[model samples]
Target chain A: MNATLVFARKEALEIVRTWRIWVLPAIILFFAITAPVLARFTPEIVGAVAGDQLGGISLPPGTYLDAYGQWIKNLSQITLFALIIIYGGIISTETSSGTAILVLTKPMSRGAFVAVKAIIHSVFLAVLTVIGTLATWGLTAAVFGHAPADPVWSSALIWLLLGVFYIALMTFFSVLIPSAVGAAGAGMGAFVLLTIGALWKPLSDHSPAGLAGQAAALAAGKPVPDLLWPVLVSLATAAVLVAAASLLFRQKEL
Target chain B: MSAAIRAAGLTKSYGRKLVLDSLDLDVEEGSIFGFLGPNGAGKTTTLRLTTGLARPTKGSIQVLGHDARAAGNAVRSAIGYLPDVPAFYEWMTAPEFLSFAGGLFGMSGSALHDRTSMLLDLAGLTDVQTKIGGYSRGMKQRLGIAQALINAPRLLLLDEPTSALDPMGRKGVLDMIASLRGRTTVFFSTHILSDVERVCDTVAILDRGRMVAQAPIDELKARYGKEKVVVEVTENADELAKEFGERPWATAIARGALGSIEITVTDLGAAQHDIPAIVAARDSGLARLEAGEIGLEEVFVELVGGGR
Candidate 1:
């Protein structure tokens, strides 16, 4: 009934009817099905490739931990890249293409437009992440004969929180940059800075960037130092980014 | 009638280039107002400013009696705007797009449904189930108007609504605007003078970002328009044109329709009296003689210095 919800429904339909529904889901699903397979057969494949180089040496057997670890690696690198690229044009494209003019000329506020986009896209990524994590959990159990759901689920959920931060960050960049390509480029640059920031102890333990290391450690069934600060910071950062995006979009000329 | 839109000292500049310069405009609440101009004459800029899509550099614009920039979305509910090249969710069908547009205005249930159906019928897209992406230029232009009317907005701002359509498409859009004459205040901008001539009751001509002329369609034509005397001779029409050019009453002369010579006159009565004498002296048979008012095109050319 709310105007924001109405516009959000239109945006959701756009994702469903356009190529957007397939691209990110397909990428995450590709990792979900193949990460476990790759984790299981990688040792054998390596041994075969080095057949004559080794003198009857055998590699260690892969485990469910390795499967989950592979999944986390793919998510942090490949899936995160896809998410940034997919959402980079979320706000910029609408304004540049003149679609925003028509909608904003109605009763809907510019802030409502940006807020709806951020909420819908973040929720979309969250849902897909959950589905992908469940798929990986089921496939990991099948490949390794046994798998713990708690560590895998917790790790994937934390990584998803970090992914939501990127979605908000991309929304902000899209508002600041009018060109979709420029927005995506700025998002990548920020990702690089965040990745570098993860190396510092305080930043890693206190910021969203730290979630990556925490996610990998959790996937390996290892104990983490502090999950509260990183989780809180990532969520807070996402909220701040979305708010800033809304503020900037209010002044944006369509 | 009260003013539907009012702008005073409205100006817009993109960096160093000034797009609009101190434009002041007023549109009556129930008139189909046409904003006529040449290409890049800042017609679209004025529309954007009035719709609150772009802010004025050094002026104020009030829409529906509210300050457009300050009120923002609060004022927009009473206004519907269509940009020059309207973009839509290409995946949405005509009805779906209209429904989406209506939903934004908080319309729903039977109200939204009926409005969507009526607009689709008006646009002649009621049965066209194809998505907007597959629509032709004309179909898209008509659908653009349909979405803008979904809320029954009091003041509709259209920026070059029919600039990119064929004759039939232009006619369809003009007829739709004409149908809204008494129901709403239509402020449509276009360089097509004939479109303004066809459907607009009042018009303002803009040249180089300034308001050159503004009045009722008839008043603007009469104030700035030249009177014409058209004469068709059986032979030597060009010679008769030359002879008419030499007269004191003829301000300008050109070739008229059907091998006739059109003489633009300072005094219609003098030109009427002298044309037959000139034709008879040239020994040319006068097949036809007609005196009439000049069209908006001639008036636009007189004021703006060129045709669209």
Candidate 2:
């Protein structure tokens, strides 16, 4: 337990020192604020730039849901990409560069090494989600004149859960592959397959990728049908991914 | 004293290529034992087996009386290993890296504090607060030693610790290793014969994945090394070489260019007694006559067969 905590602290420090703290959350926050701002001002900006081209083509007034939809869409895509970019090499780099050998020799279990990496990445994901959420909420409230707290909270939290799942999936693939780019490729490949599986009705609400797809409806206060199954499935899958990662990492040669 | 590490019929193969043949080794507790071998002589493989970082394919290993392959693998806690090229997090300061390493070994608070400080001072890295990424190779190697000693392990395994360092850096690292002579069983491998001579009490010379010799440094020299006798006479040098060659005691004799006679003697006492009498009888002025000197480099060269 102590080894795990120590390794976890090291991983957290790595994330902070490497600018993941600034880059991931800052990018997410940038999108969080800009998404709504872009949605609220699209009409005026278009009118100013291409007024003659769009002569008298009136646009609808941006509602609370429009800003909410923009936030969810931007976050679901950009934040997902950011997550992949941020943590893609978390485990693979250590293994490849021979850094893990020194640490592994010191009475630290391989399970602790992998588990701490997953846990710390999850913690960073949680922090990014909370900060992004608050920043988006404030920007949306300022633009739309009203904040739809409940649905935005639901959507952001759900997406954030999916982010944790991505961390696990990346860790699992990173162990399976030997390099950061290869690991990210493996993860993105599996992610695409999972997204495709979300289209099947039986798996649509239970697939790990289904949560991200339902974010728009989740943020619009529209009842997202069968939300419980997807959340449960995503968490269970993440747990299994982390477990598999630990097992594979234990067997890996330094 | 119990052996710090023991291996019987230990064999390891990667795919079909055998890296370590069926080999036996023993390291006694509380000795600065040098594991000497040429590169690719399975020295690293042996260290890996002892540390439980790797498993042997065809034999058993006992480290600190525990089966290293068996459950729990707690024996690793008592070991501090510095790989040939030890790398670090590259983002951590020396003290922070030590604290993190200490925590892994369940050391914390002031106990960890004092140990880290002492080790850093020992490694001579206390003043440098730069992250490990900016450290030079020597600095990193020193820090590597510090972290390895963080847990105060009973056995320290270093793989070619001086393989790639300047003389100053190697001396510093060797001095630090020397300080742990009694407290830790230092089993380090190096191809450099001088290094083993400088610090090791006992040595095991390995060749082609097989151990050629393992004994106390002096004993190994006595067993495999022949005592050399150099006689520089004003005359009758070649005649004495021929005479000594035919004698029962001289195993080999080589006459040098400068009226010098070199002889490898089986009986040092007889040769020393006989040499002066021969020089005195010949009326040859003896400038220098030195006997009973054995060079470790000769024994190492004999064991490994010429690849330094």
Best by lDDT: 1
Candidate 2, residues A63-166, lDDT tens digits: the string is: 76777788888877767776776677878888778788888877778887888889888988888778888888888899888987987888988888888999
Error of 2 at B202 (Å): 2.0
Docking level for model 1: high
Q: For the second chain of model 1, what is the TM-score against the true structure's chain B?
A: 0.95
In model 1, which runs have C-alpha deviations exceeding 4 angstroms?
A: B306-308
How many pairs collide in each candidate, listed in order?
Answer: 0, 0
Model 2 fnat value:
0.70
- Alpha-carbon RMSD, each predicted model: 1.6, 3.2
* Candidate 2 CAPRI category: medium
